[model samples]
Target: MSDRSPAQHSDMLLFLTDEQLRQGIEAMFFAYQGFTADPDRILAGMAYGRAHHRAVHFINRAPGTTVNNLLGILGVTKQSLNRVLRTLIEDGLVESKVGRVDKRERHLFLTEAGAELERKLSDAQRARMRAAYRDAGPEAVTGFRAVLEAMMDPNMRRKSSALKESST
Candidate 1:
């Protein structure tokens, strides 16, 4: 809530020095580490990895999403995602159903155990984000989100927007 207008803020970004950009990059790296720390510990105990956590999260978000759709969202090689999916399927954490319309398509869903794990992961992340948002105040929170959205490429931004729209 300063006296500056949106144009002033945009102009200010134009003058960011190399050191400023470097510092911002480092901050993002450290912030990501902090954000993932809790989930990493949880995954370690379960003999899982971040890839599995990501799959569980996205599947929970859009139950019955197709494997091809997931591959697009995750941008992982089919072989890699298949390995993770295989493990999850074998562990009884995820369920895959053959598509009725297209027999070749496989839809993914989280089982009860997967849902529980997703809850734990989400709760941990939400707690951290809640505390940070509280400390940063509403304006900073909004600005931070805008900055993040701006950083994404157009394709990713569209995908992100679609997911957000679906949630609402």
Candidate 2:
């Protein structure tokens, strides 16, 4: 693939053998496991799992996010998200307020305890990502992000980019 023209690169990608694609898919599976390993360990002790971690992370990112918006972001069923939210709320990690203007809407915010948990989870992930990016190098990091973005659904990509921009 080295020194290939962009057209050639496209052609090569289009013609990737089943074996090549399989290897890439396998790599992604393993990489995801590695990425989640630390957080999984932390969540295990709390009787929570990846779903809870994901909810906390996103809620921390966008305080006062509505339940409906979180449902969209997480792509989980209303019932399932409700279960997680109920647990978090009961544990005092999340506070859900009735929307002032919309009585049916529940806007979520992390309590101090929730923020602390989010910090720990994020710190672990950031350390892992930072080391991996350093090992992969700047160019690989750029290419890696491009590949990830390209793999996302267009709608999800837009949502993700908007969050990134807002965060910065």
Candidate 3:
């Protein structure tokens, strides 16, 4: 198998059974449910959904990030994001300011309330992940990250890589 030619890649599908594929699909579903469980509970009390959570998280990660920058990071339609932004802004959770260099552009920042909420939401997930990582050990965590990166679609992969670069 290790010595297979380039043409062998096309025929690789023949080796995978339908049952194996179904099992993989089921694993992803259950894993995602577990991943969202903690944050979902926190959001339930606040009348917010995953969209709001993501916006808060990103704004917290990059203070004074432009609306366009966030749109690219989130891959969401502008109207949809505008709705979320409106709610957050009205609720005093987030602030939008005119860009210093480009006055037409809106820059996003989380207010004290937004920061507190984001911390609460992230802390819940971090506690779960910290325990899981501790149990899985360092190598397993590395492999998990590698698998997730490999599974990303091309557009998402590009965005992910960009975010990783910006963080450094």
Candidate 4:
């Protein structure tokens, strides 16, 4: 707790200039575009967009999540989510069933085809991430993840942490 002097800490804070911050912002934009490129191509073939990918990803991550839970996680309007859900269900990629204990609640699950698609999409992204992480090295990867977590809203951060915990 008493390692660094005040002057040293101030010097480090001053190192992050406005221009440096802007560069970091631009880097993030390009990185995100590159990250999504492969999945975009695959989704384009199926006429689906990033929304569909997100829904599939989250549903695969949480097999028995409810629509209300998804809505909270996704931060999308009911109408918007309904449109995406409808298409996925119609395509047989997602199956929604009434909750056994709560008749009014709809629980979402990925069908076999849906799981296959999720695997394909995730595999592409994971490969890109693996390569990026390898190139960045472990220290940079840890910093990158910490920065990402810090950028998330408090509620989203909690949700992300919960999901990470559950997956493990």
Model 4 C-alpha lDDT per residue in residues 1-168, reported as the tens digit of each score: 555767534435456889999999999999999999999999998879999999999999988788888888999999999999999999999999888877878888999999999999999999999999999999999899989998999989999977531111
Query: How well is each residue in 1-168 modelled by candidate 2, as lDDT tens digits?
Result: 555565535545467899999999999999999999999998989878899999999999988888888888889999999999999999999999988877777789999999999999999999999999999999999999999998999989987876531111
Q: Candidate 1 on 1-168: residue-level lDDT in tens?
A: 555766645435477899999999999999999999989988998879999999999999988888888888899999999999999999999999988878888888999999999999999989999999999999999899999998988888887877531111
Residue pairs in collision within model 3 = none
Q: How much is 84 displaced in model 4, in angstroms?
A: 0.6
Tens digit per residue, CA lDDT, model 3, 1-168: 555667735546566689988997898899789888999998998879999999999899888888777888888999999999999999999999887777877878999999999999999989989988999999999988887887888778876665531221
Instruction: Answer with 2 or 3, whichever has the higher TM-score.
Output: 2
Best by lDDT: 4
RMSD of each: 4.6, 4.6, 4.2, 3.9
Give all candidates' CA lDDT scores.
0.89, 0.88, 0.86, 0.90
Off by over 4 Å in 2: 1-15, 163-168
Cα lDDT, model 2, residue 117 = 93
What is the full ranking by lDDT, best candidate first?
Answer: 4, 1, 2, 3
CA lDDT of 58 in candidate 2?
Answer: 91
